[model samples]
Target: MPDIDDFLRNQERIITTRGWAVTHVLPTDDDPDTTAPFAYTVGLTAHDHPELIIAGLPPLVAHTLLNDLARQVYDKAERFSHGQRISDLIAGYDAVIIDGRPTDDLLPGAAIARYGRLRIRLQQIVWPDQQGRFPWDSGYNFDPHIQPMIAHL
Candidate 1:
């Protein structure tokens, strides 16, 4: 797995080069409860990584935040690069999240759902681990990987 720092840096590069905004939810020191900071949501337009990623959030919440961050990327794509070609961006990433599933997606444990009915809500689970540790090649599973490819509009 790529170090979280590498992943974050890569994402920051993509966001800045593409000129997109990133939104995140964070807690202030004043807030006694650090775990559930959802009472408020923070939206940042800057190109810097938020404290959450650097601080390392709980896995479940981190996954949800990643999803939201990705959605923001897509939304920004639609806003700024609407007609511009994004094939390079699409191709460069090891994977792309489609319909909540990652395609050519190599992120480990990225497809399994911890909060919902994974089998029903998720169609496939793909990751670098399937090909053995440190396998750089992308693998596709019929039920999981194909679902996202087909669902792409």
Candidate 2:
């Protein structure tokens, strides 16, 4: 099984190589260096699930990237989970949070003319103790309002 540190290091490398700026800290309120086209703030939740905040990209791009990143993490967890069960991997952490909002929306009362925002929650699948089995089903659900933004990626 791979260590969490190695997994996270690979994740950071992937994000950087894909041209996304990964930051442990959010930009300070007083700082005025908003030149990056895309930014992702990533941190672990209290229960160990990854919480990701993505900004500056269009809604579709953000959604695609979110899915890609989550898949990457899930893949890593699958390798570490006993019996290669996705359910076991998910059971080890909290819900994965992907919060994607338009950069312009950060402005007070700013009206976004295009691309709706999305906050997706991916929860782990659970089973009854007696009926529990491997190959657990898991998926993500997004706000219905963002349906128009989803397309083949």
- Candidate 2 regions with alpha-carbon error over 4 angstroms: 1-47, 78-153
Superposed on all Cα atoms, the candidates' RMSDs to the truth, in angstroms, are 14.6, 15.5
Model 1 root mean square deviation, Cα atoms: 14.6
Candidate 1 per-residue C-alpha lDDT over 81-150 given as tens digits, one digit per residue, 9 for 90 to 100: 1112222322232222223222222211211221222322211111223333212234532233212121
Error of 2 at 152 (Å): 33
> lDDT by residue for model 2 over 1-153, one digit each (tens)?
988577567655654454222332224567545432233323222124333333444545555554555455543542122122233222343222222333342321111111112332222221122224222223323222222111111
Lowest summed lDDT window (length 10), candidate 2: 107-116
For model 1, the run of ten residues with the poorest summed lDDT: 47-56
**Model 1: residue 15 alpha-carbon error in angstroms:** 4.2
TM-score of every candidate: 0.20, 0.23
lDDT of each: 0.30, 0.33
- Model 2 pairs whose backbones collide: none
